[model samples]
Target: MTPNQATSSTTAHLKPTLGSLQLWGIAVGLVISGEYFGWSYGWASAGTLGFTVTALFIAAMYTSFIFSFTELTTAIPHAGGPFAYSKRAFGPLGGFFAGAATLIEFVFAPPAIALAIGAYLNVQFPEINPKTAAVTAYLVFMTLNILGIQIAANFELAVTLLAIFELLVFMGVVSPGFSMSNFTKGGWAGQDHFSLASLPGMFAAIPFAIWFFLAIEGVAMAAEESRNPQRSIPIAYIGGIITLVTLAIGVMVFAGGVGDWTKLANINDPLPQAMKLVVGDNSNWLHMLVWLGLFGLIASFHGIILGYSRQIFALARENYLPLFFAKIHPRFKTPHRAILAGGAIGIAAIYSDELIKIGGQSLTANILTMSVFGALLMYIVSMLSLFKLRRTEPHLVRPFRAPFYPYSPAFALICACICMVTMIYYNLLIFGIFCLFLALAYVYHAMTVGKRSPMQDEADSNSMTTKTPAR
Candidate 1:
């Protein structure tokens, strides 16, 4: 088949159905799970004070990145997200790098969130195993995604709002118990003095700090399906960052001050644990948090399932992976094959949590590190793509230019570089495994996709095009 024909075929398969509201839901929902669990792990390594600093620093990087990244998403409007942006800027190899990194981020994140979901359920029902609960979640959400985009997105919106409200309620309930003295007690990584010793712990906490806002960028994967990409994408991304930052700081500080922050640091359900200190374990507020908290984890898990499937579909559509994954379900008009494939991988990872351990870390901790590795890499490649495209494609219609031009992207790039270096330094073993995953994927991509011809490039460019931004 000709390149033109392939582009035309892909266009017919993916339908635009999302509006700004749904996009906002997806953006926030993609990372809300971070508040519920993962960020607590940072306390184990960095203490409350140390992790708070790391969270604030990482939050700055995301704020700048979302502002800059909105430009590329508006111009390209491709479901491939970072992959599409990088490909247009630097060609196929760049696309592979960004795509692999994104895949690692989106694909691995769900398993960790799924495990959290299982743990949350285990609290309510002692009989159910967390792994079994996790696997059940994978099956259920994947089916929801395969049903259709609107169905999946509407469901995402509902859960995201519920999750956000629950978080706010948590803060209110814990406010009476919050004390600055408690928060600052041994806050400097268990040291009374803020010496050079705290630096290592602070830097080592980058991944968990990153967890607070990770995958919020996955909203870009829905651009193709957004009713108005230029407007909705910006709103979704900007609003998402602000909401997450506020919640992260609020939740972390409140959780820390209410009780023995050390105990909350290493567990999956920190909010409930902290709440128990404020109100006894039998309190309804504690029960409410345990039950409603599932919404936070579910929102992210379900939204990421949507994100990863679109990514898989885009890569397959562009021939970066097997074409089998590119097929759309005729009745549902969704990437059913891609949805199932990603689910299979996640389910495997869920089970492997017990079977695999590296550096004495659980699969959840290792995958969280691995996910951050991918996020940082994708952030770096994406910023470079932004700069390259500005220099090269001077005429690309940008409805929303990044607020500070070079400065915004430059700041984001530098922060991502620092975080990447810190993560690599602290997680050498996981870093090596991340590299091996990319290397293996690249080997397959090189052998199969090879180099793109001029005709194919033109077709990809055409395929990615959508409505122009209103001047």
Candidate 2:
């Protein structure tokens, strides 16, 4: 019940089946969908060159943030990820915000990726509606997640490996057609000739640039599930980031070079559209990419379900939500309720796509912005937690310290704030919707969970420490 006891408790019921390889798979799988699509929205906001600049800057921010986040994850090693760190730093209110932000990020991200999956399938089977396919995907993957962590993680590793190789194949097939002239043909779209007006476009491009590496932080959710938490966490994060950066840059440059970047600028299937230029309409290479390419989207869509469910399970276990959601399955030893809860939301999103439309963009853009909104907030609060923890819990065991200390976290925070502002400015409607969701979550917390003390939360979290069947 005390701080010492809470810190020493292994308060997570999730199975400890993950090793460094599985961690690497989940980390990379969580964000690989971004490399497949959603990033071209940046081109719509800021042209080829502008989006490229945005991506480079955002990549640096993510690389630094991931390095810093590992310290907190290794120390707390909880399923809550950012929520656990922020709670230690700023107490219950802070933890609530971080958890809600994470739920929004990981929960909403899948719908976007699922839609992309549907789009890929529709490319082959015209009879199947994209939204219908998306809903089916949600059912299939979330069930796999609930069955067990070992099964889920094994699938993650297999699919992620396939996805990585697929990206490489895409580059090889399209490399010969790379053209600098095409890449720069309409490199700057919004501004007729760069001006003060161009600043807004470039700033607006921030979130879309972020789409390329958005949920890389999801790996932290697996910390409690790692077979060797302290040793595997850092290696997985470092290796995952390195892999993503390489893929992001390679795919972006080659895709841009192959055709008029503007055409694929806002679509959910940018890579397929990009390759269409090189192979015309019927090349076997194009068919192969479209079919095999589904692996990348599936990896993220599936892996994000894992991340969000862990977050849901963690928050519920800590009494931030109803306790039933925290229940571990009696037979599977997995958080079945939490996985179903998130999957229901994702499936609902597929059908609810047309409910609200903003700025003439499709429902997909709104969902994408919502995810970015959550990610930006999580980055800000998590970065703040890093500073607070360093000052308040200096003696806490940290297996890895961020290389630059204050500077690395501080810089990531600065970039996060700037992106948050730009996203709000560009997608005011989406930002407003996010605010409404946050407000409703807080209201629910106040009604059912506001009176709980910090120690009680720790005790509740400790409930997960019971022995479980080995995977």
Candidate 3:
């Protein structure tokens, strides 16, 4: 069957289903825009030493970790995503922390992406205010998202292809100028180079490198909306990561070869600068390609917002959040209210100057480490939940079981722990601050809201029923 016919068939099987291609598109867009650009920016700052090693490390980590997630997501394709899986596997509270951390990651990621767009815009239009661009991009995507998921998904697909194509074409055009010798120009700089006495600076670079791999988890967030999520979600998760890793490595290698490592390292927006070198000055066509890539960035923001809003909607439905956020639009069959709430947060984040500062750090260096810290917390809980559920619900009909049983889950947990230790050792202050916020949020949520059960609402509804007087 043709693509349209296939999509129609898939849609008929499940209401509110996102086709596999669209799911892939959403995953790609979210990972590329939300994670990749920031990652590349981070890599740029660390120079070749950090980039080369960290890229390899991330590729290894992502491959192993994703297989584990694919198993979980495919087994339990619920709206709550990781939160739902955790609840079923561990317990409500375990699920709560997982949901909370995932929520924070999704919430924080959009602003970071928005700030990247604003930074790129600042480069092209030096006269335009960065804050204004950031706010405008956030609002535009927010509006796009509010229209509904289909619109957002379609836009994501289009921009994802555009972004990939732009990068590929740029690479092809610049391939002729590739010079392998440039790679070694900036040989590994020691700790003394950055005024540090020991190897802490080298270790400091891990988080930045880790940042490049951040959005591989986004596929789980799209589980509820995916067409045949049991199959599609896993595929998207695995495929999206592979695609990103391949493209990223290719672009970085090609860009590194085109000029001395120092030149590419110095330019904040490497693609446009690389294009300038290849296409020469006054290349408006290349400028237009960069602009299209920026739109892809914006589309990436929309995809994350789409995934995140659904996550919040799922939480609210479970009574973990306010009921108001749970309301879906009647006609559109979309989580309209939750989308607005997520967008509002993104807009608020644009106002923070600190976001810009954080965005400038090395990809494999700082943010990645911190993000991994948060992601690892969720992963550990998720893996433990997998084991917890195996014992608790022995007969639970899992469509897809993780390979190697306890070994798989055990391995994932170990990897997560290792990443967590690395994060703490590398940047204790930032990681500690994030944990503190999570702790405070949990305490406040527990004290004020957790005590009340969803069952109480049903009981109250029964009690308020009108009784007819004896007639």
* Best model per lDDT: 1
Q: Cα lDDT of all candidates, in order?
A: 0.90, 0.85, 0.65
TM-score of structure candidate 3: 0.83
Query: Candidate 1: TM-score?
Result: 0.97
- Where is the poorest 10-residue window by lDDT in model 1? 4-13
lDDT of 3 by residue, 33-81 (tens): 6322544443344555555665666566666667777766776665667
* lDDT score of residue 147 within candidate 2: 88
Tens-place lDDT per residue, model 2, 105-196, is: 99889998989999999988879999899999998998898888999999999999999999999999989999987777767655435666
Q: List TM-scores for all candidates, in order.
A: 0.97, 0.94, 0.83
- Candidate 2 stretches greater than 4 Å from native: 1-12, 190-195, 458-471
Q: What is the lDDT of residue 299 in candidate 1?
A: 98
Reference-based lDDT, residue 304, model 1: 97
The deviation in Å at residue 368 for candidate 2 is: 1.0
Candidates 1 and 3, the one with greater TM-score: 1
Candidates, ranked, TM-score: 1, 2, 3
